[model samples]
Target: MSLGILVAVGGVEFEPSLLRVAEAADIYVVRRCVDVADLLATAASGQAQVAVVSAQLRGLDAEVVAQLADSAVAVVGVTADTLSADEALLRRLGISSVEASDDVSAMAEAIREAVREPVRSQPEFGENGPGEAATSAEEGTPPGRIIAVWGPTGAPGRSVVSLSLSAELARLGAPTLLIDADVYGGSIAPMLGILDESSGLLAAARAANLGALDAAGLAVHARQIAANLQVLTGLPRADRWTEVKAVLFRTLLAVARRAHAFTVIDCGFNLELDEEISYDTAAPRRNGATLEALGSADVVVVVGAADPVGLTRLIRGVNEVMAAVPGMVPHVLVNRARSGLGWSAQEVTQMVVRATGLATVRLLPDDPAACDRALVHGQTLSECAPDAKLTRSFSALAADIAGVPALHARRRSRLGRT
Candidate 1:
């Protein structure tokens, strides 16, 4: 069998020997990687069978190794100083074995073995996947439902809806955790009267990077706002995206899902991809956390304002999400819905239905007084405006997420006489 290999070993002295030996061993060199990032991008394409990478490769960690292995690419580390440095640290990352680059015999054997070994048959959400049995069993909670609340760049109330939905879910007796995953700018803590400067998401990310974040560790960082509601604050500054890596962010969200019945993320607005495409460096995308949340979410709530410009943005944003994310049923919510704009809800409904082809649409009435009051007091809309129409709308959202019927649904049922 012709084994495809991507070589990114350290030092120029080893490159010629690796290339020559790989050819001698019947291995076909698919790509010669310049750095760890290059190796990872190539490996994820599912073409390469094995990666002979350097043990001292910068940014080489368990998560990176796991991602490569997930793509069915077994990693083999080649190092000149394997005798001095402990191999145990790298072993945990699924490296088949570490061999001295000078020892051509051992290096060839390791590469050959990795190429011949059958890739493990595992689901995408393996033991570490979101809400998998291996993790939920330990947490003692029901399989959690993940909801990602996203909007466009104009700030159409993503945080408010996220917080109110979480609060209402907790009020309905489901343990809920609200995550401020807005890598652009997070306002969940200050909106909820949380004064703690410590960021729960950042702390969780650090622990996840070290492979130390678990259910108990997650529980410790989560700030309890109510009996069944918890909040994980986001980055205090937009520049703190460096602290939260994408892989670690996914792991943190998975752990959070295991610990709660419902995990609602107040996601950021941007969905643009990093276009630089570097072979030697990992370009930082400010919206990595947002993308991660959307990819993992079981349900996504797309919110927009009811005005002309807002609706236009809403339609464009929905199309972007539909084109970008697959396997998700998006629910579009037209917030601040009223008749002052000379277009009725019925007309707006038709426009959205024609534009996005989504059947699930909700119209939340425009109520500035109640929303402003809730924002000023740092309380959930359900708390300060108990009898407000907007609060009722948010409660309807929570009930829908919980798979239960609310007054709105009941009223609609009565009207339809179904």
Candidate 2:
């Protein structure tokens, strides 16, 4: 079988040796060029499977390293000094392997290994390309899902719900990743009491800029919050919003999906449109980030307050959510539900149905103390207040989401099985 190859050399001393190695390996040397730019372009175009570069090549700079790292081609640096800074730099740039000696046979073996080995690539959430997505799914060390929790405006309790849901999912034995995709103002790190100075959104943007963000690269940005739960917090500052792009968010979500079984995202509120509104605007918008998260969600939870104003907001938010998200039937969550409002759970459900024509699947009681304690302590409800009504309710919601039987049925099933 003929093998495709490209050799980039700074001097003519190693040209004949490279050709001999190629011939010995029964591989067709496609490009015997000295220009690093041409070599990179050829590699990027997918014409070459393996790139062999000389350490002496002046044009093989950081830009080339960054470009090669992003491309499908496998890069191997052949250097005279294994301990040289150049060799270390190449490896740091994500080169697959580096060789010190000028031995043609050894170089050829390295090339073969690099070519035969799988190349790691980034994940594409939407309709970018099949190859990109497939590569990520197959090559990912720990493939996972990207579950984006989304809702409309008017204080819908999306953040609290998402945080609780992620914690519960992690409790259920699945390795889960929680991401804060609210570009306008992300509260995840603070809510979780994580003093994270780095935001995944910014990291993703930088990755997109260098074209180096793949499943593996994104895994580096994820911070482990629990044994099974990881978090990718939001931007540190709102002014740096320009650094984030919709494509980058999509790519990061895709990567997150591959890294864990469940990747939960706390997305922004506004789903009707994409915008970057000024601070003075009443709507508070950051369209690009929110739209991307909502578009790629596997499951979306529409959260709303239990009161009348909150219900009105939920009603309007649902309409906008349905229009913005194609082919999505959201699960509604009613927050701050209490009998003191003179409305029972059933009655509140009825009222919401009457107003929005959507059923409430989950209801959380108004327990500001419990929530405040958990947020302040950086602990989940299960850890902070396991016996609280809101905690129990949230546990039930998680059980339902994970398809666990209800309390009564669980007891009966256990007795029957026994």
Candidate 3:
């Protein structure tokens, strides 16, 4: 019995010679696909165990390769030059077996090699790879941390907290990447006074789709807002969420961890799981980006308003998120802690603890004047009001998270203010 193969060389003139050599070696050509869609459909039919694809094939990307891998179709990429940039790209696209298009004689061995390799398991996002040890040990760079700011409906200030936290962390000498992963409505670009029509997240997603997104590629997309703070702006329109795939988003986050000491994501309010009945299993979900961000986060900061209705929603939201992601213990942050709300910090903490069983709840004092000033100027609170209590609170939180001394956190805040 010969090994079944699907060939999609995309107009490469050497296909006939490669097929002749492969057939001579007992490799049968099951189907010759016209495009990536045809290749995928043919691979899914279970007739082919190996796919010989051109490195320059139109629409050939990591997602297509992933789908092929999912279908148990091992791929052997044929590039014009084995040592050229295309070969490197194919390798980055997770093609382990590659053959030079001009060298048709070695095609059979490449097919056998691809089939010999085991299907790769999905890597846990943010987990360090094998090569990370030597690099980290040499550079003395610790693994970066991811903090996802999420909240219940009714505007619990997720974006505010995310921006403030990232800015504060950067002010404390930690490099930070602020990502707006809100699928419903992402306002980070406008909030930061960035009027560019292009979105960093969307750009990064495109690079990821093409298997070209690395730390350097991500930095190209991210706009440097401060000396130590860079921001990956979110979607321009809510409906454009489908353009950002969840897997690619996870890959982007993993790349972000390599480039920054801290990544703060402003997540969407929804925690609903992808429904099986309502949508196709392979289709993109509106909340998929947010869900991936939360899952990849090292810390989930659940923010909520400090009012009666807000508190009720916060409690239920916390429970809902916990149910959606088991073993997730969030750090609750009650925003806008005003005396006018008729509740002390202790009372709010007690209420949150009694309902959500959280050990501690951080309070962010209401400073509408400072917030409004920052908003109007498109600057962070530290820049506008470094001495404000709210700014000090954020500095303290950053200090705690980054292991900076809190005793002089306020002084440092003033010193680090841009």
In order, what lDDT does every prediction score?
0.76, 0.68, 0.80
lDDT for position 302 in model 1? 95
Report the number of the highest-TM-score candidate.
Answer: 3
TM-score of each candidate structure, all chains considered together: 0.74, 0.63, 0.85
Among the numbered candidates, top lDDT falls to 3
**Candidate 2 clash pair list:** 143-258, 144-257, 144-258, 144-260, 275-287
As a whole number from 0 to 100, the lDDT of residue 146 in candidate 2 is 55
Model 1 scores worst on lDDT over the 10 consecutive residues at 409-418
Per residue, candidate 3 scores C-alpha lDDT tens digits across 140-186 of 57779998889999999999999989888888777899999998989
Ranking by TM-score: 3, 1, 2
Instruction: Give me the runs in candidate 3 sitting further than 4 Å from their true place.
Output: 1-4, 17-28, 44-50, 69-74, 96-140, 413-418
Pairs with backbone N, CA or C atoms under 3 Å apart (clashes), candidate 3: none
Tens digits of per-residue lDDT for model 2 on 269-371?
7554423343322222356667777777767778888888887788788777777787877778889998878888888787767866665556789999998
